[model samples]
Every structure is written in C-alpha cells, then in structure tokens.
Target: MENPPNPDPREALASAHRTFATEIEALRALDARLDDSFGRAVEMILGCRGRVVVTGIGKSGHIAKKIAATLASTGTPAFFMHGAEAIHGDLGMLTAQDIVLGISYSGAANELLTVLSVAKRMGTRLIAITGHPNSDLARNADLHLDAHVAHEACPLNLAPTASTTAALVLGDAIAVACLESRGFSREDFARSHPGGALGRKLLTRVRDIMRTGAALPVVRADTPIADALAEMSAKGMGMTIVVDDARRPVGIFTDGDLRRLIARHGDIRPLTVAAGMTHGPKSVAPGALAIEAAALMDSGRLSQMLVVDDGGLLLGALHMHDLLAAKVI
Candidate 1:
C-alpha cells in the first residue's frame, strides 16, 4: 500500500504560535486586572508567622505546588496541601498563625470551598486566586487576587491554559513581594537551601574549608628549598607558607617555585624559601565567603591561598580544589 503524505512542519509550527499568541493575550488581560486585592494578599502572607499553605484542585493544584516550592526556596516558609486532602485530616497542618492560599478557576471547586471554610473557622487568613471574583471561594476569602483571563488558549476553551499561566505568575509575584517585605537576604535563602549549590556558594566560609594548624604546609623564610618541598609534600598541598620570625605570613613557595629554582640551578639547599618565594602572595580573611575565595582564585590565577586573621597572622590555607570538593564553585 502507498504511504500517506506527511503534514507540513511549517503549518504545525504556525498553529502552535497561534495558540501561544492567544494565551499571551489572555495573560495580558489578567495582568490588567491585578489591583488592591493583590497588595492585601501579600500583606496577609507577610503578617503570618507560620507557613503559607497553598491548596488547589485539578490543574491549579500543580501550579500551587510550584508556587509553594518557589516561596519555600526564596525565604518564605510554605508548603502545598491538596484541597481534597485538607478535608481528610490534613487540615491539621494549618494553624491560626498560618495563611492559606486557595486556587480555583471557577472559584466554586467543592474541595477548595471546604478547605477555605475550615481555615476560616480556625481563624487562618485566606487568600483566593481565581478567575471569578464573584465565586464562593473569592467571596469568603479575606483577600481575593483576580486571576481572570479573557479566554483559554485551547481551541475548545476547556483545558486550563491562560488561566493556569496567570495563576502561576500571580503566585510568583506574591512570593517575591512577601520576600521583599520581610527583607529576605541571600544568606537567609542559603539557610533554607543549605544542601544546594546556591547554599554552598553563599554559606560556605573560608574557615569551614581551609586546611588548619599542622595540616597547613608552613616553613620559615630561611628554610632551604628542599625543606619547603618536603613541607609541601607532607601537607599534601601544592604550596607551602613562608613565615617571618614573628610567625606571620611573609611569602609563599609552591611547586611553581621549585620548577623555577631547578631551572636556575640544580643546587636546592643554598636557595632558601625566602630567596625563591613570592612575597606577600594573595591571601583571604578567615571569614571570607567561599565563593569570594573562588572568584579570587579565578581572577588572580592562583591555585592556593593562605587564610589570615585581621592581624595578618596565618590562620590556614585553602586550595582551589578544596572549593571544588565542597561544591562551592
């Protein structure tokens, strides 16, 4: 049998573009409707000491989870609760100090209505994000954020398309506003996401990752080049710290120094660490953030750096590889 001809790729792409354009128009309509109620929603969330419990049914539930995740990661304490589960005893997760955000397109989702009523009885503030402001959920809510869209992107106008996007965007706006109102800092965000790359970049300090005490490779200024190499090898770091008589960092000798020394002369003993060392090599404060140290290493083309105190006393040493191992980079 002869095969049927394939559909035109350009036609398919054009159809997809039309869908996006329609939805974008709906989103614009939704954005225009944002008003005083949006501000009230943010205020209620900021006033709550406990978590923001986001509950929604159907497609709104998926958006709610994403909003909750964004809020939790960005300094606001929040979690998603399914509207159906709230009536099945999960309502206990909410308290008077908490705030509840309910999402529903029709604003009459039976599951969400039940949860909103329970929150009201518990004296928890309720914020509603819905397409219908006159809907039951909106009427009962302490604050109503109008998420109404002109129409759905779906040709049938049944599946959630523009309305879901509007709800998601509004949720993000709320989270961001609350974050700013609370003066949330990068360090504060790091505290909540300590196990992630962002946390490592912001929270890891030089003192936490540097080699300390005897583990640090150190030698006197007058130590022979061979002794410096031994110290470097013993400490397993590529560099050795050269200290003055006062035991403060004066210079540093590294594998590069040994290569230069050997290129100068085969004799190693007469060439002291002070003679071959680079004076005042780059150093960082013990309290410096690990990401700052990483940036320093990159910009300065340094493989290792000595950590020092305010008085310039050697506290420890840090290698670029150490930052890599700690996932700070």
Candidate 2:
C-alpha cells in the first residue's frame, strides 16, 4: 500500500481557468443568438392563465427546480414537476390553461417526450428549451427556446456543464422579464419571504416595536432636569418626552442634552427640563415602517424617536436598541 502524491496546484488552477473560459464562451453564444423568440417566450409565460409547470429529467431537473423557485418568489405562479413522474401521475398537475416549460439539452429524453405528449394531448402550451432546434421536442413545442451551447465545459465534453449553465441563465432571464412586466415590488417579495431578514425590515411597523404605556418615559416641560433624568433611567430609553397638559409632545431631553446642559450651566438644581430639552423633536406616525423610522433617526442622528398621532399627541417611543433587538436593522 502506498500514499498518493498530491497533485500540482498549478495544474488544478489551470483546469479551473479553462472550464470558466469555456462556460463564458457558451454564455456569450447564447446571448448573441437571442432574437424575437426570447421575447415571445416571455410573452407566452406572462399570458399563461395558470401556473407554469417546469418539467425536466436528470441534471436539467435540478435546474428546473431552481427556475420554478425563482419564478414563484418573483411573483409568477410556478412549480416543478419531474419528467419521469409526470408520465406516471404528475401529468395531472398540468391543465389546458397551464403552460409547460420543458428543459432538455438533447430535447430527446424519453421521459420528457412522454410528458410533452401528454401535455400536448391536454392542450397545454409547451415551451421547449433544448440545444437542438430540430429535435422532436422543439419541433412539436408550441414555442421553442433554443438553449444550444457551443460545447460543454467538461474536458470530456460529455458532461452537462456549459449546457446546464446556458439553460439556467435563460431561465433566470425569463423569470426577471416576468418580474419586471408584472411590476413585482420589494414588498411583494418580502411577503413571499416573510421569514427572511428583508421581510422583517419591510413588514415591521413602528407600532409593533414602540414602547407605550408605563414603558414610555414622559415628563412635563416644567419638570426639573433631575426628574427627567430619573425618568430616562427608569424607562431605559436614554431619553424622556416632555409633553404639554394635553399629552402633546412639546420637547425631548436625552442623555446628550444632559451632558450639554451640565457643560453650559453647572448649577442645574434650579433648572427646568425646558431649558435643556430640544423643541419639536422628530416624530413618526404609529403606522410608519420601522425601517423608515430607523432611517429618519439616522438622518437626524437620534438614538430615540417619538411616535405621535395626527393630532401631535404622544403615543409611544422607539429606541435604537429596540430596532436592533427586533433585527430590523
């Protein structure tokens, strides 16, 4: 028994570089060959009344699944149906209103051909993505999208490397075209991905995280600066709201203000909060997005913000720490 020697790192690097170069050339060929057929393919998907059922076999099946997910997340209704399964029972997933997107570099996989036959019998429109335009799958398709690549990135030129890359990129382009045509918005994307960070930032409202009731630190303008500081400490918001008799916020005093006050007038025992409080503090409506509030606070260089009603009555407050805790930052 003998241990094998490590291969040369330079050789591995050279092989990788060659693979990338081959794939880049394949993609360039795909882009240059694009014509009115590409636009028509997007138009067909958009016009489809039912879901886009993506079907494929083997390696193309994995790419089909990714394409389905991208289309679904971007506002188009779509799902992947395995080509082999479709001939057995998954063909029921297709309907006359649905559009079939079949992926096969050779355009001659028996399983896909079976599914295509069934889809055609059901009157389902078929969009074929194949490297051979004259293949049976492409010739029989209602619309053909040629995914032909000059060659595979694999040194043997037998693996589905560059061909798969071309198909995946074509699918992505179709998804993006549909997304723009439908005017898919960030909020819409967030809605689809509610458990993700972007969703939390877009969907969280000011009222959801603002401290209200006893958690709020409130003081009258006439209150002593020492008492306002106590309120700030008690609420742990690093600030206190100075409100009028009607509960309308007239000013705000923060830890920063306290420091500036001590520097200006050392004898603060006789001073009122009004002397140190900032008049007309920034405020937001309770319904505003928490992310928007964060931006407002950032632009004003604030650590805390007041949430007020339309009548200017203080309802709640937000601390920078709150946004961080909620992961909205």
Candidate 3:
C-alpha cells in the first residue's frame, strides 16, 4: 500500500471552511425550529417513572449512546438499546413505566420503527428525534423533536454530518434541562461516578481517608525532641502532632521545622517538642471535603496537617501524599 499525496493547502482550507459553515447554518436552522415540542419532550422524560430507553440505528445510535450516558450520570436513569436488537429480545428491557427516545435522521428507519411499535404496545411513551417532521416514526410518536438540518457538512449533502451534530446538541439540551428540573447535584453525580477523580473530590471526606487512631503520629508537648523525631520516622509522614496533657493538638513539628531547629541547635535531644513545634497549625474537621483539605494545604504551602475536633482534640493526621493516594490532588 502507498501513502496518498498531500492535499493542496488552499483546497484544504476551503474545504474546512465550507464544512464548518454548513454545520453552523444547520445548527441555526435547528435552533429556529425549537418549539413547545422540546418542552413536551423534557416533560415526557421528567414524568417517566422507569428508566429512559434510548434507541437508534447508524450514526444516531452513537449519539443515542452518549445521550443515555449523560442522562444516567446527571440523575435520570437511562440505557441505550440498539434498534436492530430491540426485536431480537432486547425489547424485553422496556416496561410500561419507561419512556423511549427514538433517534433516526430520516424518522422512518425500519429498525427504530419496530422498536417504537413494541414500546407503544408495552404502553411506553415515544419521543422521536428526527430530521423529517412527518416521517412514519414522527407521526407515530407521542412527541416529536425536529432535528432537521439545512444540509450535511459533506459537499454532496449525502452524509450524516450536520444532522448528527444537531441531534447530539439537542440531546444535550434535553439532558441539561432535565438535570436542572430534577435538581441534579454534584453529590448525586459523585455517587453515580464513585470511581472517578471528580467523585473523590466530592464524596471523599477527611474522616474517610485521614490517618486516625493508632495510625496518627503524636508526641506530647513535654516529649524530648529525639522522641518526637522518632515518632515522625515511625509514622513516615515527616511530621508529628504535639498534644497537651488533655490530648488536644497544641502544635505540629514537621521536617522543615526540624531543619530549622538543627541549624539553631545541633544537639537538641535535651530540647522539648514545645520549644520546636509550630503552634496552632491549620486543621480540618473530619467532615471537611478532601478537595478543601488539598486547597488548604496548597494555599498555606504545607505538606501535612492535623485533623482536629471542634475542641482541638487530635483526631487524625493527613499528608499531601494521602491526597495523592486518594486521587484528590
């Protein structure tokens, strides 16, 4: 096989410009066509007690999958069903309480029509997203969203380019509208996506990942400098919490403080932690968001912090590395 020759820069630029212009005009047309039907589509999905079933064939199917994902992540339960598979037992997934979102540019795809028919027979509501307003699927549907495009981005206007983009944007519009109506929140999204980094930012709390109880490195204010150093070494967090007789954190001695102390006094075994520790360091409650902790550490240019209670009682210790381990950084 041989590689193709390079394209003429002038021709390439012209082609790119035409494609973008066509798609932009198609989008403008779609916006102008938006009407009460859009509101009805949103209401249909909002009123659905069961999951939103998204079905389509070809390029629309790809868009349908994305729509289903957006709907599911943003609090509306949704799933994608391939149009071809609907009659081959996938239709069993539909229920009377569910709502069907059918995507087809022509609004007359046989595969999608069959799926919509089964949905109607099962007492499910049908919402059609199509370029043709009067196609079979649109006429049969309970609600119709016209995704009509002036022309495809392809020069011949035969490909599913502009129409697909319009469909995708329309799907996003519907999803976002439903999200706002349902009061979809960050916590709700985090709960649905617990394994992602954004989920860690929202769902993970100081108590969930902070080193607590025996895992915390602690030393008394009266403890010898050498003993405090030992606590830091044993814990491997590069710092030790200095507590009063009541077990409340009075100060924190970090590796940086130790360096400064050694510069002042080479042999500090005789010194107590109170003489070297930084007093009243910044701290967080157990319920604080992990991202807030990260921000506190970042703003103060710190690596470690004491987790304290309302009474300043030492509850746990957290380090920058802990945030890294929790994927909060």
Best by TM-score: 3
- The reply for model 2, stretches above 4 Å from the true place, is 1-5, 264-272
Model 2 clash pairs are: none
The local distance difference test score of each candidate is 0.89, 0.94, 0.91
Q: Candidate 3 on 16-43: residue-level lDDT in tens?
A: 9999999999889888889999998999
lDDT ranking, best first: 2, 3, 1
Candidate 1 local lDDT, 143-193, one digit each (tens)? 888888877888788999989999999999988998888889988988998
Those runs of model 3 whose alpha carbons end farther than 4 Å from true positions after fitting are 1-3, 263-266
Candidate 2 lands at a TM-score of 0.91
The candidate maximizing lDDT is: 2
Give the clash count for each candidate. Answer: 0, 0, 0
Q: lDDT per residue, candidate 2, 153-242, as tens digits? A: 898899999999999999999999999999999999999998899999999999999999999999999998888888989999898999
What is the alpha-carbon lDDT of model 2 when measured against the actual structure?
Answer: 0.94
Estimate TM-scores for all models.
0.90, 0.91, 0.93
Q: Cα lDDT for residue 216, model 3?
A: 83
Error of 1 at 176 (Å): 1.7
Model 1 residue 85 distance off true place after TM-score fit, in angstroms: 0.9
